[model samples]
Target: MSIEFIYPEFEVIRNESRCIACRVCERQCANEVHSYDPERGIMVADESKCVNCHRCVALCPTRALKIVKSDCALRENANWPQSTINEIYKQASSGGVLLSSMGNPNPLPVYWDKILINASQVTNPSIDPLREPMETKVCLGKKKQEIRRDENGKLVCEMTPQLELSVPIMFSAMSYGSISYNAHASLARAATELGILYNTGEGGLHEDFYVYGANTIVQVASGRFGVHKDYLEAAAAVEIKMGQGAKPGIGGHLPGAKIVGDVSRTRMIPEGTDAISPAPHHDIYSIEDLRQLVYSLKEATEYKKPVIVKVAAVHNIAAIASGIARSGADIISIDGFRGGTGAAPTRIRNNVGIPIELALASVDQRLREEGIRDNVSLVVGGSIRSSADVVKAVALGADACYIGTAALIALGCHLCRTCHSGKCNWGIATQRPDLVKRLNPDIGSKRLINLVRAWQHEIKELMGGMGINSIEALRGNRLMLRGVGLNEKELQILGISHAGE
Candidate 1:
């Protein structure tokens, strides 16, 4: 016997007087949520199929539609929430592990919101960013422990390969198969235009994007998809993806259905076959093994490119980062729990990792205490929302910040959390030709460029208010920050004091 289910999550409201029966909603909805009734000559919606992406609402001609959460309840319980019960029912019926996309939706503490920035008041007056030169340019790489000089006494400036950014923001990794070609184009063009970098997330670089190699960071994950000697040589740097924030210890799986055409060729995998990335690199069992791979990449690139080790932020992140610093890696990228992903198991995404703020603070402090902080540059990602976040991340000791969700939003993602379905109507996270064409790379690139440019201006304004003229002066300056509503342990971990103090 089929049991009656709970209420639909969303309720679609369409004004009868304003809808005009234009059928625009019917035509635009990729989920088949809207249908035109021949007998009634009206547009009707199937709320059960709605993901609430807001595409139809935005495109509606007469402001006739709105979607709201259903006021339906199932005898609410605090300990066992409605969502938990729903998940149990879903699992029992389907016998499948629940999958979700985007960042963890759990209401975990976002430290950036708790932390407050300090402004110049008396001793030091704030500078006018418009009139004064505010330097935001940053280089990500190891700093030499001691300077070397030639026989002529002229200091030699031979430093390892470094990534230079006009702004302390970068478009984080989103692979080709996980997203569309147009999305990659947008990121590549924007990175080149803004003089920053974009990461090729474990999905090997497409042949067409080779021209943007100078601004790209090629990733090498456990599956080692799309990696080759030429791919390594073409990139400015190489990143070893040990773990991702969304699924800390889990592997990545790009379903066979999304694998086709260029994706198949680029990843060097068979068409319509699941591209599974093992949880751990078979060859890397210890820190020593990690060091070997790091050196191997450097050697493959003729020691010209710096290597970055990317790991998820977890409870023992400080200790893990310390080992990576000593693993011959020039950079360490830590993804916080709130970082975005194409797909992750529902339980792991919300319950596995720690916040970026705490991890960054602890890792920076540990590296400094070990006198190895200068050995590797720290880059943090997992939901850097605004310029304030970038400033806060730097003050907490990050060299720069990576923005995945923000970049996708710039490219027209509505954060509906349905990315794993591979039917993104916005064109940012789908492989379908028709849906992919909806995103014009030319327009997408411009929007992304505008976002970073606006952020750069705001970063300068924030730095000016702090009486700092360069990003270097603000790096790891915890005195410039204060925490609110946090206990002593949290404040201590973040290396900041209470807000009022």
Candidate 2:
């Protein structure tokens, strides 16, 4: 028999005398921190395996479990906060920036909560999804204004070739190097099976995943890692990631420790070198320069696949999105401040960018006013926690939704947010071979399918309840959405009145 132990940094001291023994801690803990043994007749915790995620500490009955700093102490420091002191120790020992993965776990405003959802009752009767079919399929790309026909009534030009997805949900950008081979395989396989798309991020596509090319969306970022002619043409669409939502106005860096072996070879960059994506495209200081890169990729690919330009939702996101729509980009993906990242500077991750809800609404309104809403498809991401968020995103003018952290959770990620250390216990986001092997692609892919299928059904239900039969009908249907507890400016911008008179 083998036993593994995890010495948690935080320890829970349970005062049994104060414990009501109601098992509230057991019920609240997703990790099963508190277990009640009938023989023992008391709640016991296996502290060695506890993640110190605070699930039980927050819900203990009678406040019996008082979470405290671990008794294990380091060299004392007189002048620093506990967290700062620990950070100094970490840097002194490893000389590396503390890194974390997934979305920003720090407390931030989740606009979805502040906003509200509406349902039909006495006025327009709600339709039941169980009775009839509802469509969640969404097409991503340009839509033409009016049709033109020749003398023979043949069409001159139609809408740009959009990627027809079976659902409005897509797997977000996660590079091969940031994630493992098995993880990539699972996403590719599941994307193919679900009739959705998975992004390759900027690390380029693995040769093994080329078989799933029909379901892939390859990325071309500032670093241009592993990008070649074949990488450009071998996907349904190409995304140029200008910035990410987690750290807007900042670039990305996949540290040297993670750049090893296959990840090294695939990126075509030197091993042990920090893979740095500069904040600004070196040649692009203006919108014209942005267009240069956009058209460059387009001409190189012969306009075969739709080009998507993804930008973080910043304060000026509306203007930026409008420029992208006119830059010959067939699609614009806006990531909100709450979006996840493999690694980001703490300052940037916590205090940068705008909410995705506001960004999506503002961008759509700006594009529509400019008569350019049909110029590109809009895909938004950043803490889209459930199917309800997906429904709201489409109604707010997004063509589709992108999901990242949720997908990882389905594949067994605990949201430990320690991916930057390259020592993830779960296989979802690390280059370490031992840790990477933990995720079995077959099982992971199946789980991903199950998650998406469940959400697909929920999407259909949400649409049916809104008296909408198809996803197309729900797209940009602001009339069906009325903001609650929102200011007048916010209501005006969202194009929906406040809920109730």
After TM-score superposition, the amount by which residue 214's alpha carbon in candidate 2 deviates from its true location, in angstroms, is 1.0
TM-score list, all predictions: 0.99, 0.84
> Model 1 misses residue 133 by how many Å?
0.5
What overall lDDT, based on C-alpha atoms, would model 1 receive against the true structure? 0.94
lDDT string, candidate 1, 331-362, tens digits: 99999999999999999999999999999999
Give the backbone clash total of model 2: 1
Listed per candidate, the RMSD to the true structure in angstroms reads 0.9, 7.3
Residue pairs with backbone atoms closer than 3 Å in model 1 (clashes): none
Q: Estimate every model's Cα lDDT from 0 to 1.
A: 0.94, 0.84
Query: Which candidate leads the pack in TM-score?
Result: 1
Regions of candidate 2 where Cα sits further than 4 Å from its true position: 1-8, 12-98, 155-158
In angstroms, give how far residue 416 of model 2 lies from its true place: 1.1
